[model samples]
Target: MYALLQSTAVAPNSLTVIDFLADFVKFWQIIVFVFGAYQFWANRRERLAADKVREAQELLDSNYQAWLVVNSAQGKGGSGGRIDALTNLARNAQSLAGVNVDGAWLVGVDLRGADLAHASFKDANLQGALLSGANLKHANLEGANLSAAQLEGTMLQGARVSGARFSAASLLRADLADLVGWREIAAVNYARLQEIQRAPHGFREWAVEQGAEGNAVSEDMSAENFSTQFRAV
Candidate 1:
């Protein structure tokens, strides 16, 4: 009888040990689950942030390419004249502000009403390009080929036109106020005379005395009518 009572006491102690082990295992499982959930949430947040950065980079690249296409379309003869590319750029001209297309070929491209402020087109081929109403304020066109390019109502305030060719380019009603390096422009007689009427005060008469014909400005011409004639068609 005494041995049987001792065996019963040992069985209770073993049961207590088993219950303790079970509690410990449950605690460990809860800790692991919390840690795993935290890691998953952190990884998701990182992925979202990376996606946003990539999207921004893609948008910037697209804008840069648009500017390049328009610049390349401004080529002379066989070098340029991609009408489809020019059409695409014209449709998205608002994104072209401050684009850098330096030394590009842009002959005969239609760039009407483009926002080209602070853009770099230095030494670019803009021969016969349609640039009516373009915002060329503070733009760099130094040594660029602008022969026969349209410039009606274009803003040339603070623009650098040094060594730029304007052989037969039309400047009718174009704003040339405060143009940088205006005296150094390589312009023919017709090009020089076309913008003389818009020159500041005595500058017009001075140009006329310098052999620039002053009869190009019609007395019956009005600013509204002049702008209408040069509107992009």
Candidate 2:
């Protein structure tokens, strides 16, 4: 009779130990599930970001290829219509970050609102191109042909413009602060000189010394009439 009573007491203790183990296991399982879910979320976000980068790279590549085709067709004396079509494709490309279009023939291309920060356009022909609202911060424009290019509201801070041609280029509301080699551009007439907004310290004095004149030359000119009376001097 005593043995039977001891057995019954030990059974309850065993049941309690089993219940604790089961609960512990359940807790660990929940923790593992939460950790797994977090890992999945983190990985998914990383993948999405990588996908965006890839997409941007692909777009840039397409533009580059189209530009090359245009150049090649021109070199071969091909029909102007085909070259124009290819040029249009290149011009309308989106997300051109970190692209290298150095020495490219991109004359008259529409690059408005492009993300061209840290891009290389060295010796590229960008004459008459629409570059309004483009982000050209830290871009390399050395020896590039920018004559007659539309640069309204363009961000050119820290851009390298040495030996670049800005003759006849519209710089209305363009940011030229902290630009590298700003004094070495090919030309800076009154019209181009008036486009500078928040011009680097002493740049206004330098422009005045360089013979720029007109209503846009004053520091207190109304914004509406600032570039309206711009005349090359």
Candidate 3:
């Protein structure tokens, strides 16, 4: 062995042989280290991700049970205590509509249906939450982070949604009547006229001037152009 090592060390091509073996050993070690590191990181990431999912699911189950209690009370007479309990559960449910749960940590809660009208949820953390069919009418959701939340069929009428991030959120068939731009409001007015024209309720020349609820007023046609071509129909 000594003779062989000495021959390899002193040989004319000895440098090349030493270099090749060194490189081969380094390459094999690097491959093993890289795989071990990768496996460790992957397992750690998966464990953390699974923990978050489990926590979210547990919150959903708790909220659903609270919903059942509130739902049962609908057929019976109740007082402020029931309202308080429902409010507490609503705060936990991922479907919190208009409740005053501002700045609460509510990640991944399920709040699909519950009256949250005029509730305040400003700056709440609601990522990955399910809020479908919830009534958020006139609710204060300013600056709330709702990224990855499911909001399908939710009523967002008159809600204060300034700076509220809904990126990648689901909003299929959601009621955006209050959030309509001027152009959409105009379209609604035009459709309303068409409905009035096709009414079988003897509504000849019915007009809906914007006013406080239910009170109707007539516009002065004489002050404006009376010709059919110039009519404001």
Best by lDDT: 2
> Candidate 1, residues 98-198: lDDT per residue as tens digits?
76656676677787998878877788877778888888888998888776677888888888888887665667777877778767776534453464224
lDDT of 2 by residue, 54-163 (tens): 99897777777765655455433223333354445536754566666677676777778878889888888776777889999999999987766778899999999988
Q: TM-score of predicted model 2?
A: 0.55
Pairs that collide in candidate 1 are 74-106, 74-107, 75-106, 75-107
Q: Which residue runs does candidate 3 get wrong by more than 4 Å?
A: 1-98, 180-233
Residue pairs with backbone atoms closer than 3 Å in model 2 (clashes):
171-195
| lDDT-based ranking | 2, 1, 3
Give TM per candidate: 0.55, 0.55, 0.39
Q: What are the clash counts of all predictions, listed in order? A: 4, 1, 8
- How does candidate 1 fare on TM-score? 0.55
- Cα lDDT, model 2, residue 213: 38
CA deviation > 4 Å runs, candidate 2: 1-93, 211-214, 217-233
For residues 1-233, what per-residue lDDT tens digits would candidate 3 score against the true structure?
Answer: 99998887788687779999999999999999999999999999999999999998987777777656555544343231344455557566445443465665455566678777887767766655667788878787776666556566777776766656554344544665554222212111111121111122322122133210112222421212212212222
CA lDDT of each candidate?
Answer: 0.68, 0.71, 0.55
